[model samples]
Target chain A: MELTRRDAVAALAAVGATGGVAVGVRRMQDREGGEDAATDGASAGDPSDRDTNEGTVRATMVAVAEVVYPGEVDGIDEFVDRFLDGRLDGSAHASGLREAVGELADASQAWHDAPVEELPAAEREELLRGIGADTADEDPDGTTAERVRYYVVNDLLLALYASPTGGELVGIENPQGHPGGAESYQRGPP
Target chain B: MSGAESVGDGRSGGDGTTGDDVDRTPVPNADVCVVGAGPAGALVADRLAADREVVVLDAGPRFDPDDRLARRERAIRPAYDRPDVWDVGGERDAHENAGEWFYPLNHARVKGIGGSTLHWQGMVMRLHEDDFNSGTVRGVGPDWPIDYADLRPYYAEAERELGVAGGSGVDNPHAPPREEPHPMPAFEPSYSDSLFAEACEELGIDIHSVPNARNSEPYDDRSPCVGYGTCQPVCPSGAKYDATVHVDRAEAAGATVIDRAPVQYLDHDADRVTAAVYATPDGGEHRQEADAFVVAAGGVETPRLLLLSESEAYPDGLANSSGAVGRFFMDHLFAGAGGTLDEPTRQNHVGFYTSACDEFYDDADEERAPFKLEFFNYAGPSPVEMALSGDDWGDPLLERLRDGYGNHVAMGGLVEQLPRADSRITLDDDRVDDRGNPVPRIEWTVDDRALSTIERANEVQVAILEELGAEVEWVAGPDATGPAYHHMGTTRMSDDPAEGVVDPDCRTHDLENCWIASSSVFPTSGAMNPTLTIAALALRVGDGVDAWL
Candidate 1:
């Protein structure tokens, strides 16, 4: 797109060449092809809300973690909570996790008639599975709902496999946390 | 030959001052001043300390296994990146700035007391007899001045000292005639090894257990391998044979190792090294005068150190009268191929790629560099790597993960790279390491001969995988080169000083009192890793310096 005088500041803001909310608005426009980001629409399950309820997001992650994380490792749910807490170290990706969880909680409330954390174990697993199924069937690039679900499942799996306790499930008393321990050894499907 | 009387032959005489500096700093004394405390230096120091005083200086920390183990337990993966476990600034920083693809191969090198062996997967494969005379037979790189026969006895001694476990002469077609058998029984091949063995048998290729420097049972007070799987980066148990093991033995024999002490330069007069100046960790300087010197730093750094030791008497760098220092840098091109099988064998998740096929080693075709075929088991983070494919999610993802998780295997090669004068390591004018030593600017990349060989190896691996009812997923060409941990050449060995830096005995031609005790003196890097060869050559170097004293 051509950088008009009006779009110049916005274009510069995208790269932090300029600063402030007005510059930020220009950055959003630059990303969205010079459109007003505030007026631009978001699809279902969008995490566009400026303020996220950290308490709800943290609670939902704790409860959902028990059902989604692999293996029946004792204290894994708490481990995941502590792990995610440590992951939120002031980066935008860290902040996006909280937002992603909030969007997911809202989506779960819409689909299963309750937020993910309030649901029982069996129901939570089913909800997460359904979200995963929905995520899998969508475009490989992923939708907002699929992305939210992807973040939830993958984060849980990463944290679980990273822990020493999760290492034992695959006979790796010391799992290379980022390795394909169980997946590489056990043939034909998890 | 007393340590005191054998003071440096430089202009300083017996007093402790260098001509460059006006300060008359008193110099410490040693019969032999060995540079770098890695495997080669430490092992050589063992023999040097028998009757003579020895001093080993290292640029890295002196952290013991306990220090590394604590870091390993704490950091998730890639624990070697931890500050206390690694030097944040050094040759690696230089490699990064130079922007080479092969950086990772040797970038994981450690500077601590143990050297890179601190984190190496302890495989100790011997060089083929034919590997000694590659230039004459295959017309690739220069032949080693010393052959396998000259080194066979030293190899056995090194293996016994390092606690090697393997099927001594059984099944291995290329196992050299040895004076002694392995110290312990060979580790049983993992299920994955069985699959490769079966396929290799049909292909008329021999697959045998690799000679590993790990205790199969307790020997040398070190425990046996507990199958930690995470042996790379850092071995949790003391089972892995590290250079520190020899360093400790050398220390017990009275070879003093001063860690965090980097040698800055050498003071020389005519043909003899007089004084060696070193920078301490605190940015202070110390001078050590010795009767003889052993430059046993790894390939890249050894040449860099020699180049950095330039003086008025030797402006082109010590022992560089032939202009061969920092030239012909070589590393093995790591090539391989693998995929998931149609059906899962019991082989999934086994420790170490135990079997190797060296039948193709010196197949001496006109185009391709001969290579040894190596296989790897799905023991490490295979499960995690497969799951993160980013293609599948939900039940489909789980189903995909389960289908091929344990059914995967790969066969690869430590393919050969011919030494070229153009692919050398030079000093960067601007960038300096923590000690202000000029960092090495490595110039290297893949060549056509290596590429052709890699392709052939890839084709063979794919055919083998298909024969085993596996679907091939990926294959990398041999063209991938550089920064191989098995670094050789640079200050390569030659009978004539006009053609190379060091003599066949590893003593530099220009300097009578200095010798290179590492693979940096290797004229050619064979398909096998350089560690075993370095150990053998280091033994010979010890004897060479002993005669000098």
Candidate 2:
């Protein structure tokens, strides 16, 4: 019953194919049942197949986010996808969020073809630190890896832990709160 | 201003009724009608619907937090500017023209079940007792007909309803005595909060944890906050307070919520509102008759609704016999000072705001100037806003954010705005909303009293920053500064009709059934967040309506 970001993206891709992107996006959302399927497919293959550049970036950003908030839940990938694909248009602050992810991915590939998990924690940390330092120096004008690092990590944290899946992780037994608490302290609806 | 009427789907209306409506459409109705699903309306309906029929109507559509997050890549985005096609008043000119400085003043409030509380920062504080009796104590602004004692019980009820989390220890001198402890523990403070608290202690000022409506524990069925940093967009965890929770409770209690029901005007008889007329999303007109009417449509929309409903009974507007439908508007004045701290005290804290000050809240000596310096809470703007406001990108931007994020502590002052007759909300001939209601024309100018208070507060902010070992900078503006969204005192409460619009009970003096449920009924703009007071007054108004029924 848990919804994942991958399911949302796949549904979004299907909607895009049907030429009802807006309607499809709204529909996919109306029914909250598609997350399991989306996340299932998401974990099976490399996200790079969808949009190579953006996918590579997203994966790299996810790796960087894992460094900031280790052992984050699964929804972080979907959050990055939504941001890069332009879901939060009215609110997004940075323009090259997706591109920064791609650069990090490219750097990771160039440095070592091994999956991020294969690398030792110290090596991974060093790689991210090096990338951040280099990006900070090179793109004095563009969104440095340092800046993007925080964005990616923060978004991932919010998606993995702040979303419903994350709520389950923290063992929030009441979901909204106890019924009496709902009536007494309830400010809004669930 | 130009008036051009465009019906839905680019059609023009020839006879006031659009051709789309000419095809007779069925009207929609609910049992207990809630005009707006904002904090006040939502809370009232949620509580009242336990026994009565209730229908909550909002002008906007319901939004899923997950979907919203997926759309806006960043967890927290600015109130203004977005990737979505939805016009959340995203256009910058609206905020700029309104003189909003801190955050976007006219950002889109979600039209769905939750209302604006979805994105609020959840800093809930009770207004000082002096705020209720400002006219008597300060001898400025119109006197409140009802005192704090009259509202204390309701405030307690509201606190319970909102599930406020704070330490209500007797040591706190400024707050009224609470009958019960907070529903949950206070949110853990950020490094900035601790730094501010230390600085306040050094200055011999008492600082404590700010009371928030955000759930610190699973009080209701909702989950606790997860420190998502998306409090401005939507709390995906449902930890932060929003009206949607109440709408759900209302629904469970047999209350219905109708989405996209935009009320246009009210049909009134001499002193009683007979019915409310609304235009649906499909360009259809619907009228709902009610025994009693509650106008919880916010300060801007409420007055605009009254002015739009001008009739023969009251030529100026509904309940405007006193000519005070949209007068005496007030918003808290905010200013910030930033400087380098002496120590590396920054840590990744869980929540945004932690410390507060009340030492200068009640200092009313004329020789010492009349304003209070309270701490302003923010984890700084989002990465994008910080980048935009500071030097464009690179190490400088990163260094600024990293260095300033926790080290910087801001103190904002909310001065009591003297109710001048000129600071009013009138109808704008040019700008019209989608429903053709005239956009409220705000003709406000800060009085000498407010300016003097601001000047004094600015000096105090600078002194405090210096004392805290911070290198300081102060930002100020003309009479109008900060966001107008914290709207107050348009339909003020008073003992006499000549001085204000609504009576002590928030009922319009001339209209028997018509009631105003917003910060508009405030006689003086106090130095605290208006959300708590707005909810308290709404609870009081709901009780009055229930009594009348």
Candidate 3:
């Protein structure tokens, strides 16, 4: 069976995410990271992200996608989850995805009393904020930090913008998936 | 068409078995062999195909846009910016910047049948009259042998052919004289455009409608632009003018077009290119001889091909008698600024690059290089984008994405980069393209003159942003986009053989039968997009070759 869009490069864009938010709009990590102090997830040798199974990584990513895009990404989480656990074309830099998810889960468990996927929406948001704030200036030139950003934020955004719904948010219809043709100008966001 | 077979992407060889034995055997001679199936080569081949035999070749696939789309989907999972349809995915390294210059040339210019035109945003503009006299008047770079007057007619013709939508006698400062009106009126201005006009007006800056190649009202069998928001990387609809249309025209006019055929060498005897040799995907060679040859293989590939076509007659390279084949390189000095505006402006999200101002070139700067600013109504550093800065994710992320997603507006400019002998393209010793040919290594820089210009642009951007009550989010340095997409001036034209590679007619001084129809022959990089000029020159070069033939 053919791999779905969400399972394809949207998952592989974890490689791109590890670098920065990509597809040319904004790849550079930003400043003004809002972080909350670590309370629970902090542990010796990073005990927060202990579950390194492929399933945990995929589940964490689905939850993370919801956090990144909110209500806009409700229906497409499964395919993205499949893509994260599946193979990717020219996926040169996604090796750290599992570790990245584990890090997020570790942070979630440390801050909350559960893994990242099991954390409450509000807590997940708070944990992601803390991680982003912590990562804003950390590893100014390192790949590990970039990988973290990817696991938490960039990959989800990549998947969102690459999808038909995402393209609609940006005003592109009848794109590569369908036969090419013109439509009435989309004046504003739906 | 001309006894030369037309080969599509699939019909061509695949990997080691890329070429069939029949194709590998000697092919019949074409009257004119045009390298590159992009706009320039396609225009040349189309102009010559009616009377003279022509054959076109491109290093990328030549599937219908729809077919290519299907193939891309079936091959890779769906994603934005998937460039397998256009990007050569091989040896062409981005760019190597040396010296104190901090420019990173990671700009995307394609190598497909339509070249970078497939991904163009359709902001077409002609070079100013003074652009031809930079060498004589500004003493910044070499002057063109022919002036704006010589190119004016061809510009009109090209505008008509490309369906340029622009105002007639809008009386903009710093624009070249036009003999005829634009084929179509300017596209409707966005709400952001009106706001920008008001804001810039308060600061005494004038913004005008930019000429675009996208159809305003269905011209040239192409549909009008439906404002498919994402224009870069690829235009989903055929509304935006790309070279694929002209390539189709060339084929319809009885010219054989070959895809996935990379020209390896040009067989020459002293001053004449006898045949053009190309490599197949399966590691085989296919030679196509022609009475005439036009090298329109884009700025990078055109020069690289010349350097690669080295023989005993010209060890340095073919058409390198003056050693000017790959020197004097230039791209527009690009820089921009963007931030969140005080209020929501969804027009910024829905429109095209429909506005521009050349106030930077309105009054010439004797101290620094001249620049022309273009405004992007759709400029963005969206709230969702800024959320990556670690500000928020859940409710906060939605809030930010909703707040400033459409409220951002920005302006960027292309400053005229004066041609310099030191800023050149030399063959890289180590890196080889997918075809195993040595790629061109660019040694580019911006002097203090350009730095000052950039500093001024930053000031202007800040002023405009502040005028609109927008907070400054990000400011790119002098060369914001690195080298940008407008690659020009490598195989520059000059009447003097010692100082230039091609003549005023775009004929290589070293070889009379060879003509350069690409922007590679630009003597100076104008402060605007170069596609219209490239097409005009290709049409001119087509005439020159036709007359010579």
Q: Using alpha carbons, what is the TM-score of model 2?
A: 0.71
Supply the DockQ value of model 3. 0.08
Residue pairs with backbone overlap in model 3: A7-A83, A40-A110, A41-A110, A41-A111, A48-A106, A49-A106, B13-B18, B13-B19, B14-B18
Tell me the number of clashing residue pairs for each predicted model.
19, 45, 9
Q: Is the docking of candidate 2 incorrect, acceptable, medium or high quality?
A: incorrect
| Residue-level lDDT tens digits of model 1 in B446-519 | 56787788788887878788877777877776444333467778899999889899998999999899999888
Candidate 3 docking class: incorrect
Clashes of 2: 45
What local lDDT does model 2 show for residue B65? 38
Ranking by TM-score: 3, 1, 2
How far does residue B474 in candidate 1 sit from its true spot (Å)?
A: 0.7
TM-score attained by chain A of model 3: 0.58
Name model 3 segments beyond 4 Å from true. Answer: A1-190, B1-27, B67-85, B92-106, B171-173, B347-351, B382-397, B479-481
Q: Could you say which candidate leads in lDDT?
A: 3
Q: Model 2: runs farther than 4 Å from truth?
A: A1-190, B1-31, B71-87, B90-105, B108-112, B188-190, B347-351, B365-406, B475-481
Going through the candidates in order, state the TM-score of chain A alone for each one: 0.58, 0.44, 0.58
lDDT of 2 by residue, A1-190 (tens): 2437643343222111111342344345446554322221222243432233323444565555445432433454554455334322211222234434555556666787765545675566666666663234222124556444444433333333333333333322111111112221111112
At residue B87, what lDDT does model 3 achieve? 40
Candidate 2 lDDT over B1-549, as tens digits, reads 000000011122323332334332222443346678788788778767776666666665555333333322222222124323223442211211231223333553444456667656677777777776765676665557887788878777777778887766444576655667776777655445566666767777676666878887887787776554445554546677777677777778876666566777888888888777877767777776666777887776677778888988888988888787787767766644555555543322233455566566777533332444555444233332343242123334445544554344466666666666667677777766766666667666566666677777777677777778876654453344454257778788888898788998998898888778888888877777778788889898888878777
Q: Candidate 1 DockQ category?
A: incorrect
